[model samples]
Target: MFRKKSVLTFLKAQVAAFLGGITDYGVMILLTEIFKLHFTFSILISGTVGAIINFSINRFWVFKNQSNYSSHINSQLFKFALVVLGSISLKSFGTLIFQKLFQIDYRIGRLITDLFVSYGFNYPLIKYWVFRINEKQNAIQSN
Candidate 1:
């Protein structure tokens, strides 16, 4: 059963991601242009900051998972961290490959890489694994 709620939730998550992306890009620009930081290091820090924002919004707002945060937050955070670490690796390498092999601009390459990583990897893993509804909760809600 394809619920409309699921679609709406996804849309909201996308919006949250878009906002987080702006934060990420802003930090990268600030570090690189204002502070003269290296591009790769800027990306590393900015991406981690952005992932923190994305995780907060997705956990509280987008997914609306009612799990006991006090008891489960650490576990959830660990899983989310794993996913973000993988995403960071994918994005960093993907952007480098696109720029070097295809002669794309770094910004453009990053955009493309972000799109692919967010949709192809992040969304699915976050939805099904990180914020998955517990079976007991699901059964209770169903009944």
Candidate 2:
């Protein structure tokens, strides 16, 4: 069973992702359409920016309620960086493949790719591994 805290944390994480995605997607569009950069290249640039925003939000707001996280900020950041690297790689390849397969716009393909990467790849890692919100810990906290 999941605790209410877990549910709340999930919601908060979604919010942070949304905020970060907006910045990332916006930059991607601007770079691709306005600056005439390749979509994939734009994604690489914007993804890094978005990761920074997401990390800050997750550190300060989404997972802020946990004890000792502030003290372990450096470690949390290291883990989060690893997750973001994977997340960005997945997004880059996924969007390219999705666009080619579906013959859709890169923007639309990226949106679809982000949905999967953020939920399937990003969320679980950020929750359990990056932030160290393990099941055992949640169970004890709930009790």
Candidate 3:
């Protein structure tokens, strides 16, 4: 069983994910439908937009209680960018495979692939790498 605080943090992260994911999906659909962008390229654009939303919520709210977030802003942002790049790559690749192999619409493929990528890749990295600031490091900085 998870500790109370840990469970709460996870819940908050999920909330952040939901908000970000909605924006990401909306943008992708809009680009593909209205702008006639390819689904794969749309994913890249939308994922970047979503990452910004996710990062803001994660930094100021989701993971803030665990560490002194402000002290390592530069490092966190760099790491977050890396994670976002990876996540977008995975989503684009996975969605394409799902569409080809399963003969699904790109929308369905993307939704399915997102479930895996969001949980398997994005959240873990965001928790441990992106927003998991080092308390000792911040303490030293503060001194």
- Each candidate structure's count of clashing pairs: 0, 0, 0
In angstroms, how far off is 142's CA in candidate 1? 6.8
Per-residue lDDT tens digits for candidate 1, residues 58-92, read: 98898877577576888789899999889888888
Question: Which window of 10 residues has the lowest lDDT sum in candidate 2?
Answer: 64-73
For model 2, residues 1-143, the per-residue Cα lDDT tens digits are 34986799899999999999999999999999999998989999999899999988987798763456465777887888899888888888988997888798898899999999999999999977887756675566567
In order, what lDDT does every prediction score? 0.86, 0.86, 0.88
TM-score result, candidate 1: 0.89
Ranking by lDDT: 3, 2, 1
Q: What's model 2's TM-score? A: 0.85
The local distance difference test score of model 2 is 0.86
> In candidate 3, what are the lDDT values of residues 1-143, reduced to their tens digit?
34986799899999999999999999999999999999999999999999899989988888773344565787888998999999999999999998888899999999999999989999898888776647775565347
Better of 1 and 3 by TM-score: 1
Candidate 1 local Cα displacement, residue 75, angstroms: 0.9
Measured against the true structure, the TM-scores of the candidates, in listed sequence, are 0.89, 0.85, 0.88
> How far is each candidate from the true structure, as Cα RMSD in Å?
1.9, 3.0, 3.5
Question: Candidate 2, clashing residue pairs?
Answer: none
